[model samples]
Target: MTTTSSPLTQDELKAMVGQAALRYIAPGDIVGVGTGSTVNKFIDALATIKDQVRAAVSSSEASTARLQAIGIPVLDANAVEQLSVYVDGADEIDGHGYMIKGGGAALTREKIVAALAQRFVCIADESKRVATLGQFPLPVEVIPMAAQQIARRFAALGGQATLRLKDGQPLVTDNGQHILDVHGLRITDPLAFESAVNQWPGVVTVGVFAHQKASVCLLGTASGVETLTY
Candidate 1:
């Protein structure tokens, strides 16, 4: 007795789990769509059920367009009252619920959207589950005017930082800011790190998403989808 292949690629895996997680999505509930390959699958899945929900807010412009294209009513963030549930994908998740996000460069909006939601649901592959965060470089969204200053600050803190770029020009976020992906910050306390980065001027947002606790995490593995509750 054996099982068939769950999915061939990561995108396929995301769709399988994302559709399963839709069981929790209810009508008339405000939703937030996260940015990432996994979240892309979730968005694609949501397109099928767009008319089933009330309204949606996107963490990235890219996601908003996709949602609109599928007939999912998109709401202005300023007009939004309260988000019922925020469905996002985590770059890394530990047992304590701490996570490192922004691998897709929308950390600022992602955090904002997550905070507006009452519950945050993280969807990812098995590889994203970890005992601790910080094996990867942490992305910090910064104002273009202060990118160099921010880099100097990180250097003083004994961390190497690089400004993400596109075709010789600086990479601009959806919000029109630069991203300084800092390396070698041993984040013993993700909450503290998030605050520390926030303390900096022109620091729009950091990839460290501790405030958004995962009420539930939908993890796709070789066996199948696994739901872990916080």
Candidate 2:
């Protein structure tokens, strides 16, 4: 990866990487699109090439609307057997490409879409890269009845889990489940932690993307976009 001399603003960097992601697309391919602001930039860029790809499989309803609004077709994930690439942003991505996502409360769907893709291409500003995971709170979608029980499980693991709130009430996910954002964790073994948490009864999906880790990352820097291949 190389850097440019002149520095660019954060939004400029995001747009730069967003536009750069277009190179990964192949004509007539079905793309797996993710959610978030950085990804929103990618979605806008995708509109310019809407006719190139057959259709998009979005991770959230919001993204589906955006794609349809731009005249790009959106397909149900069940209809697509596999995708050429899944482009999404990470809340925190480590050296190994493992990430903590779901900051947008779309973790469950994001993971589902990611599972249907052959490649996971993570797009992010440089700030999202980290030496280790877990500085950002880990989001876990849980069955409502087990919210408190799940929180206690995190406490036993030395982390604090709190129900995510919006409008002074529990924020419900698209799956009609509640989210528990766990804090105070330093995830050295993301795969193991993810496996363990997922085994808990109430857990629908854990924010850790170890199994569906990124194959490549387009990191936006002050200078330009840096490509990292894992």
Error of 2 at 6 (Å): 8.0
lDDT of each: 0.84, 0.93
Writing each residue's lDDT as its tens digit, candidate 1 over 118-217 gives 8888998888888777777889999888988999998887789999978998899998888988887777788887888799998998888887768888
Candidate 1 regions exceeding 4 Å error are 1-8
TM-score of each: 0.92, 0.96
Q: Per-residue lDDT for 94-148 in model 2, tens only?
A: 9999999999999999999999999999999999999999999999999999999
| Candidate of highest TM-score | 2
Query: What TM-score, to 2 decimals, does candidate 2 have?
Result: 0.96
Question: Worst lDDT window (10 residues) for model 2?
Answer: 4-13
Clashes of each: 0, 0
